[model samples]
Target: MQIEIKSLLKSCGVTSIMVTHDQEEALSMADRIVVLNKGRIEQIDTPDALYDAPASLFVNGFIGHANFLKGRTSPQPGTIALDAGCALALAGTAPPPAHRDVMVSIRPENLALVSDAQPRSIAVTIRVVMPLGAFSVIDCVTASGEAIKVSQSRAAWSGRPGDAAWLMIQDISKVHVFEATTASPSIARA
Candidate 1:
């Protein structure tokens, strides 16, 4: 119905503005999106641009399911030292300035459960599991008490709550960094 309405609006050459709470609907139907929080404009951009390059932590957390880790920029380029006592190298782009506090954001779908310890792997305790047909949502908590969520295909994962596992990022390019204090506009990428 929404798709049909959108198509009709487009075919009639009429500019339409829709206010919707459904993220998927907004993403699918709109040519441009303006995300508002507490009556203030958070960010405005095309759907893909908004999802791939959210300007603030609120926008990042609001637009999609994201796992956030508190960390500080490492002395090494393209790296951050997580408060969990591990380091993660920012992939595909230059790292934030050294010694700066940052919040690392990675979408749940981009994370994978690993069996062996590997580079940028973090140990977590599975706290909950939710099955959703083709995929399952796994909730995990790190040693540092930070919560993380993973969305994986049912066939790919077969773990239960209370299980200990290693979580690894499959793609470094999907990592997003924001200033810890203000969730400022994305600076590392653009």
Candidate 2:
């Protein structure tokens, strides 16, 4: 139904306004999207733009499933100390001034299971595994009880509940850092 409607809209060569609460539908059907939160425009961008580089925390959360982890700016520039007992090196991004509370978001697809030999790997205990056809969603928890989700190919991952594993963020650039709302709502590059 959706494919046919989209085809008709395309064939007609006319602009059509589609309003929906479904994020996936909006992303698939429109060239540009405006995200509204509490009746205010939060962001306006292409789906890829909104997903890859969200303008705000609200838009980041609204567009997809993001693991919001607590972190603190390390003394070293471009480094973040996660409350989850690991540090993230965001070499490609701008860091906030040292010693500030921050919130970090990493999409599940950007995380991969890695060996303990990996220097930047994070330790987590697997909690649940949901196989969704070609992909598998694994739920894990850090030492601080921070829940993180990882999506991997079903055939590639063979872990079970209660297993301790290491996770490596596939792309540090995809990691987004935001100011802790306790003081103010702001954006950070990492």
lDDT of 1 by residue, 1-190 (tens): 9889889999999998999988899999999999987789989999999999888888887785678888999788988988866798777866568999998888999999875677679988899989999999999999999889999998888888998888988888889998786543232122
Taken over the whole model, the C-alpha lDDT of each candidate is 0.85, 0.85
Off by over 4 Å in 2: 115-117, 182-190
Model 1 error, position 80 (Å): 0.2
CA RMSD, predictions in order: 4.0, 3.7
RMSD in Å for model 2: 3.7
lDDT agreement of model 2 with the native: 0.85
- True lDDT of residue 147, candidate 2: 86
Candidate 2 residue-wise lDDT, 2-105, digit = tens = 88888998899989889998888988888899998778998999999999999777788788788878999999999999998788989677867899988898
Clashing pairs in 1: none
Q: Which 10-residue span in candidate 1 carries the lowest summed lDDT? A: 181-190
| TM value for model 2 | 0.91
